[model samples]
Target: MLMNILSIGSQGGWTVAIVGYSIVFLALVCLVIVFMNLPKLLQLNLRKKLVKEGKPCAEVEDLNIEGNVNAAIAMALHMHFNQLHDEESNIITIKKVTKNYSPWSSKIYGVMNQPR
Candidate 1:
């Protein structure tokens, strides 16, 4: 029976894993659904507010920002973010280090003696 297989799976930690996975999956699914409809939900609220203020539905429903304006906004954001120019005083420093007796630099202990 299908119940036998269900019992076997339930006895292991598979049940907990499956339950947690399903919970997360369902939560993400719910989030996706809400996000997908979020714009519509906001628009509905805006429409209601507009109607309450005696504005017609047709104009309110088809409201859109112009493409050129949107592009300009996008370009401005891009320029603002991608401003890679940093003010710098062109200066460089070089130093040399020498240690005369470091154990790491000494070669005396590096050789292994052969066994006869």
Candidate 2:
């Protein structure tokens, strides 16, 4: 910043680019962190609401699923999704149709010869 060499301007192009990239990277990281914790935050909020409404603590047990149960649920979901789509043969067929050319259907002839 103190000196410019080899026709390099003191405007700090690299510095601006680096700072801009750093800001964007930091913002995206912050967004990812928020999204990663969003489900937990939502669950906590739901728990608060459920408690306020005097719902039975049994329903709260639903929110406290273990890792194994989570894995089972994920597997079940994966299986259900896999079953939802029908299998395709993945074969493509292109059929060409042939039609005889008729003089009555010729637009070029009709355009060249005008009606009297």
Candidate 3:
């Protein structure tokens, strides 16, 4: 009975495959739709929760200063720290040293007991 039901050449097998694929496709479509609207849904729920708790749901605004004002601030900061700052100095320097590769350098090899 099981062999008859699972036979690939039979109509039952094709029907089962079609039904399985359709259900998976539908589930994937539903997941895609849910994910697409998830952010807005979360925001709405958050706003509702905030209102219920008697808290403000105001959106935060970004600071948009003028370019001239930014330049002035930068100049003021540079002038204030002029004495402490270095005009021509290396921030970081890396010196490479050549070393022969050895298995003993690894932690696994180091864990082995060695005779004195």
Candidate RMSDs in order? 5.7, 9.1, 13.9
Q: How many backbone overlaps does candidate 3 show?
A: 0
lDDT at residue 39 of model 3 (Cα atoms): 65
By descending TM-score, how would the candidates be arranged? 1, 2, 3
Model 3 per-residue lDDT tens digits across residues 6-114:
6748667778889999999999999999998986686788778878988777741133355699899999998889957556575688899998988868676564667
- Which candidate has the top score in TM-score? 1
Model 2 residue 34 CA deviation in Å: 1.2
Candidate 3 accuracy as lDDT: 0.77
Q: Each candidate: what lDDT?
A: 0.82, 0.82, 0.77
Candidate order by lDDT, highest to lowest?
A: 2, 1, 3
Which parts of model 2 are misplaced by more than 4 Å? 1-12, 36-40, 56-62, 65-72, 87-116
List candidate 1 stretches off by more than 4 Å: 1-10, 41-85, 111-116
Q: Per-residue lDDT of 9-49 in model 1, one digit per residue for the tens?
A: 44767778889999999999999999889878878888998
Please give the range of 10 consecutive residues that has the lowest summed lDDT in model 1: 107-116
